[model samples]
Target: METLITDIKIALGDNDDFFIKRDYLIEEEVVFLGLNTLLDITKTKTTLQKQTESLILKGKTTQLLFNLIGDVFENDTKRAISSILEGKLIIFIENTKQFIIYEPISKSINRSIEIPTNENVIQGPLNSFTEDIDTNIGLLRKQLISKQLIVHTTSTGMVQKTNVSLLYLNDKVDQKLVDNIKSLIEKNNDLEITDLQGLSKMLEFSSWDTISKFNTTELPFHASQFLKRGRVILFVNQLPFALILPNLIWDMFIVENDRNFPFPIMIAIRFLRIIGILVALIAPGLYVALVAVNPEVLQIELALSVAQSREGVPYPALVEVIIMLIVLELIIEASVRLPKSVGQTITMVGGIILGQAVVEAKLVSNLLIIILAATTIANSTLVGTQSTTSIRLFKYINIILSSLYGVLGLVTGIVLICSYFASLTTFGKSYLYLNIERKDNSG
Candidate 1:
């Protein structure tokens, strides 16, 4: 049974990080194996000693007993060795086929919690939340005080146990939703969950899911509001934001802070946001369709102006749109990656210089400049990064369809988008469910 362990040692070829020791865990004799380079030696041993004792006392055999970032692997020579490379400690029973992967405390990350400089909110709420789990929960605890307020903490990841805290109003929260979430967390107890996107997989959302299943925010007030409305707030260790489940379609248009404004003003703003959504989804496709495939759809003067703006451009309307879109995406990516001072200068100067240069060079039409600029601006109007990304994905579908079938393709794209949204669900609640209210219906 220790042949697997023997094989790993040979494969590693006498590395300094690879070390083993004879030990007794829970009165069971075993050998401890790990890489010293990856593990914080003192913390790793301490966590396993305490957490394993708790697991046994709680009548659990398997859990965060391996590499902190990986899962419980099969009894294979390669994977056993791979787990060691991924910063996991393996506990092999001397004569048994069983082996437990103990928690590996990773090297400390050197950084202090800072406010999010990336995202901007119109109706600003104070976000004093930080990376530390205790500090974040303490912030939320101050805002939510009730007997039913449950903050259930658990560990995930096989390599290292990352803390996950579930905050919900027990009396108000739907039991089914909580049960379902807990079950997934338990099922994947040995799997690492570092981000909400990975958590989506735990919820069984497939690759085709364009709309994010949860809403994320850094503000304690926002998380508290969602909890009161019978929604769950999931806090991942070191994640600066709290993940609010069942990200509904309305989240694109409505936010809790907006209610501070007068009702009519909120309504007007929401209406404009909806219009922006449509523009982001349809503008590029509509422009291509009208210019290339359905010129007669436009009035004579408008069509003439469009044609004149496109003069001397050497590519088809679709290619021209794609070229310009790629440039826009490059600029956006660059802006995000560069420093703030540099990013602003790059975006401002890049947009002006590039836009003018492309038009003069006839690489793209002048009319497309107006449409794609509007598209980029409208895309920014959506609430979440995930929402904007999902909507942005649909434009490619629309572009392809419209290039083939004109106005009919754009209509087809719209219908498909609607149907997709209608079928989306998060924890059994419809994605389209807007207002926060209690209901018995899970369908």
Candidate 2:
């Protein structure tokens, strides 16, 4: 027993937080090992005393003690050390190389469940996921009360061992998809995944790819909806959001709030969102293409007006577009990094001042400003922030292509983008496939 204690001390080193409490259980001496900062020492001691007293009354035997404890592990030093590090109270019985591990009352500092700040909805559940994995799973279970909803949890990260949960509907989801995901996770068990982004990078195997193959949401109801639609949801330990796999092209225009409205209204709103996405992606590029290469496509009056707007501008259309795009992007990034109230003020002030000043200074044309303003507003209608960012980035491709080949270049860029989307796959599922059909019996 003394040797075991010495080994534990050596493994933990001289860390100030490491602690050991020695107690007597009848004729045997029991030692408790844990971290002072992590364990609720008072509750742990009380429970230990009560359990030991009861075991003594029943039978003072090693087999009886093991049966009472229910978590006995035979002499494994490494496992004992790991359990202690994870805040579990490790019990060492004298003369018998056995350990019992259990969790005691400790400070669980987790954010209170509150309304989602970013993914707000008018007619759905308001509560969002908190940082606690148990709380998040409880919220999901409350919303999706079904026996088919399976949650498989495992710990990743060799050093930290962060908890990861894979949630899916057993009856609806394809078994092949589940196997693929589990295989990927098991293969990367050595990775140190601290957040959703890190886990996503590990799963996707690329950090440079701007497109997200998963739909991330903080709302449990949203996650439940996706699970019913044959999608798998992944939850990380400390992340407040859940990731839905096999992100489809249709996901870009989906708005969860639209479901609250009437059927016709929902359809119209979704159709308009699709139009908004298209306009956001191609409006600036089309404007530049028409002015630079295909002015004949415009009516005489509009063409003359556009020409008049550019009369005093010094830079060419392409350079002017690039400059305005950069300024707009900078304003956006600044607003996001600033406080909420300050961000709103800065965005409004920056947009108004910069737009007016640049046009008056002849750096850019008035028509271009209007086109860019419309484009920016339309870009916000995309479902997820990631999709919006990807669209914003891809717009530049269209702008450059239009500058090179006018309208034809814009067409080519759009075609290439569609091709890219079509070619992309997540967990062997095509990005373009919506997975609306029922799975086969084999699935």
Candidate 3:
């Protein structure tokens, strides 16, 4: 018993919350050990100790313990330590050198379900996925409500075990896709997955890849909708969002809840997202190309007006664009990281006052400010934030190319982007990927 207790202490070295309590079960000295922070020690452990004492009188120590607890790990100190950390009550019978490990009352560790702060709800379910994977799966199952919704749970991580679940509709999901995803995970079992980026690495995606291989949504409604459409949704423990794999080009322009509107309205909404993406990608580069390289393309009167707006700007068109773009990027990043109430104030001050100040000070042209504001607003229209990253980064390439070769370079950059999307693969599913119908006997 002393050896086991010392082993546990050694395993969790110097953790102040770890504790061991000595008590007697009717004159038989017993030891209870666990993390005090995680275990319910005040009332629940006391009641449990009383029950163990009563059970001991009725039968032999080992026999009664095996009967009462039904989970006894003998001499496996590693397993014992893991159990203790997981909030299980550990009782050791000192004289016999025997130990029984069973679950105790664990303090409430998970937060309640709250509305998604990331994904805005249009006309769908309000509650979103929480940090608890089981609760998230439960939320999904409540909406899916079908036996065909298969949840395959697996444990991953190198030193510690983390539970991950893959949810897909058995009747609609492709068998090949499921097998491929499962095989990729099983083959990389040794790879530690602490976050989504780690999982991306485990999947062997290039770090330099511009577009994310998956799309994320905090909304359970969107998750369920994706599952119904024959897509796999990955849920990592403690991650409060669902990752929809092989995120396609169309996902950026499409919102599942847009179906709530009439057919014409839905089409119009998707069209607007497409238009927004185009404006975001083209505006900054077009500003540079027109003013610096292709001023002759504009009408005579328009060219004169553009020249007038840029008159006081000391820097060339490219430099002026770069300066304003950097300021805009800083403002955008600050607004996201700050607290919501503070973020709004920062946005107003940085966006309105700072923008007007720069134009008046002639540090950047007024036309450049209008172009950047439009780019920032248009960037937000993309469906997923991860999807927006590609545009945000690639737009710089467009700006550089446009500044050099005018409209020709911008066209080349756009073509390269199209080719990049075309070359992406999500478990062998490319930009043109779609779900294969499940065979009737498959499920």
Candidate 4:
């Protein structure tokens, strides 16, 4: 016991927050080890003192004394040390050479469940996941309310040992899919995962892929929906979002809240989102192609009007599109990184100033300004930020191709994107597969 204490002290170093409280229990020297910030010192000490008094009055044996501690108590030295580090109170009985680790009485510091700010839905549960994992699990359980909703927890990360939970409907999910997810997690057990991105990469999901292989959401209702669809959900400690695995292409177009609306309305909204994606992806390219390479395709009056619009622009259509795209991207990045109030002001002011200045300087046509603005607005309609980012990035491909071969190049770029998406898979499940018809579709 003395050697274990010494090792723990050495490992923790001289941090001022680390505390050791010595006392007497059942005529044996008792010691409590924990972090001051994490443990409720007064409550722990009082509880220990009261239990010690009770044992003495009853003349209980050491075996009885051990029974009073929680089930988390262990005889293993390494595990005891780990528990102490993880904010658990470690109680050592010097004479018996025994140690019991249990939960501390720390104040609740987690934020209360609130409406999701990022993934807003018009008619669904407003509650979002919090930083506390147990709270998050409780939310999931409340929504699922089924015995088949299985949750398995394991610790990862070398030094910090962050907890990760795997959730799925046992009867609904495929056995092979569960095995595959567990296998990947076990292989990456040594990784120091600090966030969702780290875990995604550890699972061998490519970060550079244009389409995200995981659908992340903060709403427990959405997570429940994913589980019902036979998808695996991963929840990391301290992260406010859960990751839905084997992210399919259809997941990008559908929103969980859509189910609350009329069927036709839901279908119409999804169709509009798809249209938004297409316009965002191909609008700039088509504009450049028609003006620079395929002007003959337009009617005489429309072609004449386009020519008049571009009369004062000194640069080629491609250069002009690229310049505006860069500016738009810069504004977007800056707005996202800034405070919301400041971001709105900056975006509005920056767009007006840059658009006016560039047009006055005859650098880009007025018609191209409208096209880029519309394209930027359309890009915002994608389901997730990652998906929106992918769409925005792939637009450059269409822009480049159209510069080379006009409408034909734009069409080719679209086909290439579709082919790439169709060829992709996550955990052996095809990305392009649609699971709308079946409840337990594994593809």
Compose the digit string of candidate 1's lDDT tens values, residues 1-443. Answer: 56877787787758977788888766667787888887886787687788667767766644333333234445766656766776777777666766765557877552454555535656756665677787788878887877888988887777656888888888778888888888888887777777776777766777567777878877787788888888898888888888888788887876777888899998888898999999999999999899889999999999999999988999999999988888888888898899887888988798999999999998888889999999999998888777888887889889988999999999999999899999988778888876655655655
Off by over 4 Å in 2: 24-28, 47-70, 436-443
Query: Candidate 2 has what TM-score?
Result: 0.92
Tell me the TM-score of each prediction against the true structure.
Answer: 0.74, 0.92, 0.90, 0.94
lDDT of 3: 0.83
Q: Regarding TM-score, does 1 or 2 come out ahead?
A: 2
* Residue-level lDDT tens digits of model 2 in 189-266: 878889656887668556666788778898998889889888898888888888888788888888676899999999
| TM-score of predicted structure 3 | 0.90
- Per-residue lDDT tens digits of candidate 4, residues 224-271? 998988898898999899889878877778988999999999999999
* Candidate 3 lDDT, 1-443, residue by residue in tens: 78888888888859999888888654667788888888787776577767766787777575655557647667878778877866787878777667878677778878999998888988877999999899999999998899889999988876867778998998788888889889888988788788978888777778888888888999888888887777899999889999987688888988889999999999999999999999998999998999999999999999999999998889988788888888877887888899997898978786899888888998888888889989988988999988886788878888999999888888988898878878888777896555433446743
RMSD of 2: 2.6
Best of the two (3, 4) by TM-score: 4
Clash number by candidate, in order: 9, 0, 0, 0
- Worst lDDT run of 10 residues, candidate 2, spans 434-443
- Whose TM-score is greatest here? 4
Which of 1 and 3 is the better model by TM-score? 3
Inter-residue clash pairs, candidate 2: none
